[model samples]
Target: IVDRIDDNKDGYLTTEELKNWIKRVQKRYIYENVAKVWKDYDLNKDDKIAWEEYKQATYGYYLEEFQDATDQHSFKKMLPRDERRFKTADLDGDLAATREEFTAFLHPEEFEHMKNIVVLETLEDIDKNEDGFVDQDEYIADMFANEEGGPEPDWVITEREQFADFRDINKDGKMDKEEIQQWILPQDYDHALAEARHLVYESDVDKDQKLTKEEVLDNWNMFVGSQATNYGEDLTRNHDE
Candidate 1:
C-alpha cells in the first residue's frame, strides 16, 4: 500500500499522493459495488438493466402484497422515488442503464453529469411539503430533530445562521434546486483531500507534513478505515459457494 501510494519513489507519502490514493480507493469501491448490483439486477444478461427488471427484482414483493398502499414509508412511495432516480440516470432516456449509467444511478454524487439528479433527489427528500423548494424549517429538520423541545445547541444555532447566510444564496428564505446543489455539493471542498490531510496530521509523529511507511502502518486502521475493510470483505467473499 505504501509503495503504491509513494508516487514519487521518494520513500514518503505526500498529501497529494495520499489524497489521490484515497480517491482511487473510493472509486474502486463504487465500481465493485456497481458490478455486484448490476449482476443481481441485470436479469437478461444483455449488459443493461432495464427499469422494469430492477423494479420487479427489488420491489415486486411489495407490488404483489401492498399494491394499494400509499403511506409515507410504503414501498409504493419508494417505487416512484427509485423510478425518478433511474430515469435521471438513464442519460439516453431508454429506460435502461449500462454499467456506467448504473454507477451514476448508485452514486450520483461522484459524477459531474449527475449533479442535477442529486440535487433533485435531495430536494425531494427534504422538501416534505413538495413546494419545489426547501424552506429553512425543512432544511434544519433534515439534520436535526428537536423532539424534546429543549433549548437549541450551539451547533444548531450555528447551522441556522449557516442556512441564512450561505445556503439561502438569493436571500429568498428557501433553497431552490440550484441552492440545494451548492449547499450539498460545494465545489470548494474536497472530502478525500480533507480526510487524507487529517490522517497524515494524526499519524505524522515526526512533525513532518509527509508520511513515511512506518507512520502509516503504525496507524493502519486509521488509513485503511471501515470502507476499505468492507471492500476487502466483498472481494474475499465467494458468491459461487
Candidate 2:
C-alpha cells in the first residue's frame, strides 16, 4: 500500500504525496478521442493528473478508473503560441486580464494568480466596468494584477485560498484596489499605486502617456515570475504527437 501520509496530521487530507502512488499505464492514445475531450484532461501543463482541475476537465472520468482512462496520449498539442491566440483568449484586448479572461487564457500556473484576485474580494472593487470580466489593459492600469499564484497551478484547491482572504475587503464577495493594496504593500498603499501607474504612464512615448493595450501587457511578464511556460516551445507548429 502507498503509505506516505497526505497530511502531516492536519486531520484533513492535504499535503499528500501524489507521485508515489500514481500507477502509470500511460501511453500515446488517439488524438480525436482526446481532442473531443480537450477540456476533460490536461490539468496543469506538466501533462499529468489527479488534481482538482483534472477532475473538472475530465468529469466523465470520475466514474472511470485512472488505469482505464486512456491507454495512449490523446491531447492534440499545447495551445497555439501566437498573437492571435492571445487575442482570441483576451477577447477584450486590454492586455492585462480579469479573473474570467485570465483563467481561460493562462497556462495552468497563471490561472492560480487569476483566481486569487477575486477570491472573496468584493466584485464591486475590481469589476470596474461591470463587464463580468475586466479588460486586461485596465487591469494593468490599476495594478490590481500582481505577483500572486499557487505552487501548483493546476490544482483548484490550492494555496491560493489563503491569499483569497486578502481580496474580499468588504466581505461582500469582491476585491477593491484599496483592499488589495493593504495586502500588497502593508502601510505603503500610495507607494504601490504610484509605482504601478508609472509602468503605464512613464512608458508612453506620446505626451498623452495613457496605457496602450500592447504597452500595458509589455510588463505583465515582470509581475508573474514563473518559468514553466512550456506552451510548445519547440513544437511551434501545434501538431498532435
Against the hidden reference, what TM-scores do the models get?
A: 0.86, 0.18
Q: Which stretches of candidate 2 lie over 4 Å from their true place?
A: 4-36, 39-175, 178-241
Instruction: Flag regions of model 1 displaced more than 4 Å.
Output: 67-73, 226-241
| RMSD each, Å | 3.6, 22.1
User: Which residue pairs come into collision in candidate 1?
Assistant: none
Provide the global lDDT of candidate 2 against the true structure: 0.36
Worst 10 residues of 2 by lDDT: 19-28
